[model samples]
Target chain A: MSDTARDRILERLRNAPRQEAPRPDAPASTAADPDRGARVGRLKSLLEAMRTEVHVLPAAEWIPRLREVLQARAIKTLLYAPETGLGAALAEARQQDAAGLPELVAYSETVESFKERIFAVDAAVTTAAGAVADTGALILRPTRAEPRLMSLVPPVHIAVLAAEAIHPSLSEAMQDGRWSADMPTNLLLISGPSKTADIELTLAFGVHGPKELIVFILDD
Target chain B: MANEPFENNVDRALADAQLRKNFAFAMGNFILKRRAVFSDAEQTERLRTIGHAIKQRALSRLPELLEQLEAACTRNGIRVHWAETTAVGNRIVLEIIESHAAARVVKGKSMVSEEMHLNAFLANHGIEAIETDLGEFIIQLNGETPSHIIVPAIHKNKAQIAQIFHEKVAGAPYTEEVAELNAIARNTLRRKFYEAGIGLSGVNFAVAETGTLCLVENEGNGRMCTTVPPVHIAVMGLEKVVERLEDLPPLLRLLTGSATGQLVTTYVNLITSPRREGEKDGPQEVHLVILDNGRSRIYQDPQLRQTLQCVRCGTCLNHCPVYTRIGGHAYGFVYPGPIGKILTPQVEGLEKAGTLAFASSLCGACEEVCPVKIPIPALLRRLRDESYSSAPESSVPGRGCKQNWAERLAWKGWAFLNTHPRLNRLTTALLGLVGDYLPPAGPLERWMRYRSEPKFAPRSLHRRIREEGIADE
Candidate 1:
């Protein structure tokens, strides 16, 4: 039934008198040299305003910081992807932990098998593909190793970001990453923890997705 | 509510003090937030211009771009469906659900579905469709349609929501705390996400270059609905398609900033396909349903084509004086505010919905804040003229619906007098003599409902200028 509907709709659109409105030139190219320092500060303040926790640390200190974040929050189980480098390190760290860190669970199987377990985990840690400075967002391209639900289903989402991955704007991030040519099955730009101001315009966080978003900005 | 007269709806809404208070507070906050984000006038103007251009470009070649989008989506393993009207759109969705043998469906916020009245359609077929957005959930529980596009339950205060949740959700306790209310919704909806056989959402932008459906949302329910369920179906107005991925950044910025004053929403999900091989999660089947409804007819006219350029930012609603006072319910449509005034009459026909065009004060606030520069006030004026026009060339549905002999004759007489300078002058002089004694009744009564009648001066402005020896030029 809709085959004809498609043809009919497209036909109508084509037959319609064409509008001769001028097409605008491409948006002005962003500045060639974006001040990375100012962007980082803006990103930090923006995230903080949304109640997301941001920690700046040397590259080698993220693991320790991650442990502290888990301990401080008293997370019982931490979901991770064992295929990623950070995930392997987390596994190794969990193995050596005599101080009783959160139990590590690998999301290695299909969601059909891991759905209940992933949902029950206290927190999940994922590596952000990149970050947008202007909007203070963390971009995640869900690969086979780290699926789309990791950052969403868990109560707390802890993302690790290298300082260099931050872009001045979303346009720059898309252009620099060549997103248009090679797109992922699912891409996410998450700015803050899940929130809503629906009822009487009263702001509330952690409505459905992660209640807490903690970013570890690794300054290399 | 859908069948009620627009004026009666407005009267009832105005009479409700609580509704008035809710709208005032929410609109004020929305204005402040939008102003804060777009504080730099030059930058904001550039962005709006670029946004408007992008929409126009896409619309100028809407047919080719839609074909490109369909081809790209097909290559990505996502099935595409087209519907000329809402009935077909709803039927397509139902068939998809039946194919999955799904009885329970969880939905994210999609105004397109609201336009279809999809929930009611599904319920009639014995399919339970649950709304997962917090605002949507509250309104769904109360058996109400969304009052605002962005905030579906903006018409209801927290107390009213507490009452609805208490009465609707099983074993739920009444609480006015916003946090507690949100927690209740989260707890109730998460299980539905995990268990529902199908998930449905609305597309914010469909990229022709990449076949990606982008959803901008503050809540993660959008992510959850598109991810957790085994099958995901997305519905969009065909006009939401963009020609390229780069078109998204500016449009997204304008939409969020203008709608809620956010620099970026909490999540902007770009879905190109279902879960790929080796993926552990995400929906395995993704379907995109594009509904034309009355948009194709609307696109036939060059002037009305600009209406298709809207990004559904809802900023116009926040800034509209009429919307602030009467709220969304008074509009009696899927959309409300200035956009609705011009859009509804076109889609539903002027005969039934033409009165909405008269609801606006033509303040131009809506156009000033429109992200895509839709020229809403101009469109409103156009719709008003269409309602009264007897021109055969007017293509609008139910054109000249409001035309009557009384109004036509009055306008004709006024035109004739204005064309004859001597007679117009005589009439003015006579009005200056007796206008003050004219009764403040009849048609003037409605005009003076909230205003005082102006007393005409004994001398006309033209006479005063001549007596003062002012040059005619």
Candidate 2:
């Protein structure tokens, strides 16, 4: 019956004499110099306008600076997936700071076992696959190592990205990288903190996703 | 309710001072926010033009593109279904959940599902479908139809929401604080997200080129609906599909900018398929249901088909003078405002929704802000023409007192008298004497109900010009 319905609907469409409107050519992504500080400045300004906290630092300050934010916010029991390289670096950073900072928790073998912990964790940190400079959005491709929840379920999301990974637009990011070749199961473009103005047209933050999206732009 | 006749709804809406205040406040902010997003006029225009072209091309080649979409989705291991009517769509959804024997389903805001009334159908078959979007959740709790497309609970203020939450949800307290109200909803829905076996979402843009379903949202409940559950189902109108992935950028850019006046929403999920091999999470089973309730009939007409270009931004509602004045509830349909005036008649029988055509002031505010540039006022006029035509089969709604023989004869009589100069002069002289004294009970009274009709002059402009030989001067 579903097949018959499909056939009938498609047939109606097929029988209608096609009035083919011309397909549009997508605008080419503007190439920007990867080393340009102007791109970061623009990205930061845009991100801040969208209510994201953009932190710029020398390569050495990356981990230490993150520790400072976590300590200042009094975030206890930070979660990270140990298998990821960023997770490993985070572990080293924790050992270096080694006191008055949050306790570090790694992903248990499965997201199911630690589901309760994930909901209760103060914050989660992950490595951003890349970002778009025009929209000031972080493009995340979730794998088991840095699962979807790390950036989503937690109240605070700390994503560290190298400066060169910032593309000028979604079009540029699509063309420059092999990101689209084998697309991940779930791909996300997060522009700012989870927010809503649904209540009396009043803008409120931290509706269901992260309240704070603090980005660490490494100058590596 | 959509089932109600429009005039009664309007009367009720007009009397409710609160509804008017809500619409005025919401529309004012919506207008300001939309303007703020498009501060760069050049960039906005470029994106709007591209968005218009993308919709035009996809709709023009709808059959081939839909076929490509199904094929691509099949290749990507997602199930796809088609529904000729809302009833059929509801049945399909029920079947999918029944196969899994899923007891409960969490749903994101999908106007298509609302059109189908899937929740009532599922409840009859003993499945609870909980709405996850906070606005939708509130509406669901109160057992009401959505008054607006984008903001389902726009009619309700924070205090009302808090009151509803207190009464409906278990062990909940009432607080007028918007943030606290939001927090309560978040905490309440979080459990449902984890427990539900099936999740439902609306498709923002279904890219035929890649078989990807792009979802745009700010509150993140859409993510929860599509992500937390083991089985995910997406429902959309057939016209929602775009031909290529590249078409998405401009459409999305304009959609967010126009809707809430944001360059991009908080989250844009590009879902290619269910969770792949060795993946930690996401829905295991993904289904896409394409519904063609009455859109194909609209598509057959070249002019009326442009109405399908609406991206559901609610910008039209914000800018429309009539919509802002009467509020969405006056439209008496799921979709309200200018787009609703054009769409309701087609989706419902023209007789049922024909009166909606008159709801618009024909101000054309809707067309100006439409990212896809659908000529809404023109379509309303077209529908009005169809409604008044003598041919019932060819007309929408098929019945109208406005177009009845008495009304036709009155106009015909007036035209005939005006065309004959001698009769025109005699009638004018008689009407100037008596037009002011016409009884308070008939056609003249009806005309005077809203505003006083200006009395005609004792002498005609034509006669004075001729008598004075003004033409020669």
Highest TM-score scorer: 1
Model 2 per-residue lDDT tens digits across residues A1-220: 3358888898877766567688777864554554447778777888898799999887678777887888899999888888888888878877876765688888755555667778889999988888887777888988878777788888898898888888888877876875446667778998888888777878888887888999999875
Candidate 1 lDDT, B259-351, residue by residue in tens: 999999999999999988888888899999999999999998999989999888899999999999999988999899998888889999999
**Tens-digit lDDT track of model 2 for B1-473:** 66777777788888888888998899899899899989878777777788889999999989888899999888888899999999999998999998998999999889989889899999999999998887888889999878778888888888888899899988888888888888888888888887789999999999888888999999888888888778999999999999877677788888998888887899999898987777777788999999999888778777888888889988998898888778777787778888888898888866778888877778788888899999998999888888777665443445343577877898899999989989998988887778777777877677688777767777777777777767655
Clash number for model 1?
0
lDDT of 1: 0.91
For candidate 2, list the clashing residue pairs, or say none: B350-B397, B351-B397
Task: Give lDDT tens digits, candidate 1, residues A1-220.
Answer: 2359999999999989987657677667666646766766777888999899999888888888787888899999999999998899888887887354688889999999889998899999999998998788999988888888899999999998888899988888889999999999999999999999998888999999999999998886
Which candidate has the highest DockQ of all? 1
Evaluated on CA atoms against the true complex, candidate 2 attains a DockQ of 0.65
Best by lDDT: 1
Where does candidate 2 stray beyond 4 Å? A1-3, A25-35, A95-97, A108-114, A178-181, B390-402, B414-437, B459-473
Clashes of 2: 2
True lDDT of residue B408, candidate 2: 89
Docking class of 1: high
Docking quality of model 2: it rates as: medium
